[model samples]
Target chain A: GAGVSQSPSNKVTEKGKDVELRCDPISGHTALYWYRQSLGQGLEFLIYFQGNSAPDKSGLPSDRFSAERTGGSVSTLTIQRTQQEDSAVYLCASSLWAGSYNEQFFGPGTRLTVL
Target chain B: AQSVTQPDIHITVSEGASLELRCNYSYGATPYLFWYVQSPGQGLQLLLKYFSGDTLVQGIKGFEAEFKRSQSSFNLRKPSVHWSDAAEYFCAVALGDSNYQLIWGAGTKLIIKP
Candidate 1:
């Protein structure tokens, strides 16, 4: 089976621009999550969607960062007015279900560089 | 607030040497623990996970981790490491049954030398 996949393996954009990253989870996954990884740092939780429940946006760093999952499969993370600090690897992951502990499958990730 | 700690930022060892990566979590009760690995230019892969029952759980690539409730730690160990085992290891914890939101440690970089 195909694992999680992300588009735009690498993206370079100027500061103050907007960029959208896409993620395609497994066929039947019900939970999708987004995270950010800075150089030599750990993964920072961003947002997650579980089934039909309202997505958890508490981990979103700021209002400029938002994500949406359509039809419970694909997810898109949008950054409005991106800053140089936004430069990092944006990662997406999916698990079998949400209620219990399930191993998360991660995508290769999209590296976003803001110059 | 809950947090995961990986004390070592980097560790260097020769090939075929024993390895151990430390992980600790701060929580009111035992939570689900996980160890993930990321190779260069690759995505994160689950090495193993600890939920309940046995304290020692084995994982892929000759890796295993022991969960200690008293110490609040889940340490990863490998008896003999190959050069290809070099990569970054992360420790994460899920608060309850929900596994979507996980608290991650800073990570430890393993350097293998032949």
Candidate 2:
């Protein structure tokens, strides 16, 4: 079976610009999550979606960060007015369900460099 | 707040030597524990997980983890590590709640020396 996949393996953008990272989850998966990884900060959760339910966006660092999952399969994470501090690898993951015990499959991740 | 702790930032082990990565978690209630491995240029792969039942859990690639509730720890172990086992290992915990948001550790870089 196909695992989770992400697009734009690498992205370089100037500060103050906006970036969008895409994620394609496995078929039949009902839960999708986004996380960011930096040199100092291991991996920080960004947002998560479970089917059509309301997304849990508490992990989003700021209001500029937002994510949307369409049709319960693909997800897009948008960072508005990106800052140099936002330079990091954005990872996406998916699981069969949203339960705490479900095992998540991760994507290769998209590395975004804010210069 | 839920949090995961990986005390060792890096560890080196010789090929064919035993390996152990310590993980401690803090949560209000019983937590869902997980260990994941990430190669240099690959996505994270699950090593094992502890939800309930048996405290010892086995995972792919000859990896296993034992959950100890008394210490609130879930440590990953491998009998004999191969050179290819060098990578970053992360410990994560999910709170026993409806959201199930995961709290991740800083990750430990595993180095294998021949």
Candidate 3:
């Protein structure tokens, strides 16, 4: 079985540029999550998708950040205009289902550097 | 809002010595507790979780955690630590009604000495 995978292990971009990060969850996983990890900081929850239900966007920092999960398998996190503060590792995770009891598997993550 | 706290920013333990990482959480009602380990340049690996039933939970790699409701704590412990155990440990809590969103701690960095 394959684990969660993310694209562009490392990305360097200028400030104000837009970037799209992709995540492919494990086969048959119905719960997807996105998180941001900054240096010396904890993992910050970004967004989450559970099957066909509405995605939880409360954790998204700003309006510039958005995510879409298509066909309940792949998820794309988009940053419209990146800022220097947005420089961090973006991690994706998935579980069999969205619940408090299920364990989530994580991806290697994409390190985004805004210069 | 649910929150987790890892009071120790860093801890160093000699190899073959007992290890304990303190984790305290704040949330209304019973919450789901978890401990995860993350090596440098790698994704997080779940150490253990406590949802209900037994307060003591065992996880992979000889790790275990005790969930104490009286203190609102879920501390991770291991009888002995290996050098490979050096990594950042995170304590997270999730409320059952929050759609599974986790509130994470600042993390504690564990260092192993020979």
Q: Which residue pairs does candidate 1 place in steric collision? A: none
True contacts kept of 1: 0.82
List model 1 lDDT by residue over A2-115, tens digit each: 899999999999999999999999889888889999998889989888853545789999999988888878899999999999999999998878644777899999999999
Q: Which stretches of candidate 1 lie over 4 Å from their true place?
A: A52-54
Question: For model 3, what is the alpha-carbon lDDT of residue A91?
Answer: 97
Give one digit per residue, the lDDT tens place, for model 2 in A1-115: 3899999999999999999999999899998889999984578988888985545788999999988888988888999999999999999999998877678899999999999
Candidate 1 per-residue C-alpha lDDT over B32-96 given as tens digits, one digit per residue, 9 for 90 to 100 = 89999999989999999988999999999999999999999999999999999999999999888
User: How do the predictions measure up, each by TM-score?
Assistant: 0.96, 0.95, 0.96
lDDT for each residue of candidate 3 in B37-62, tens digit (9 for 90 to 100):
99987889999988899999999999
Q: What is the lDDT of residue A89 in candidate 3?
A: 95
Using DockQ as the measure, name the better of candidate 1 and candidate 3: 1
Sort by DockQ, best first: what order?
1, 2, 3
Q: Select the stronger candidate by DockQ from 2 and 3.
A: 2
Q: lDDT for model 1, on a 0 to 1 scale?
A: 0.91
What's the best-to-worst order under lDDT?
Answer: 3, 1, 2
Q: What is the DockQ of candidate 2?
A: 0.74
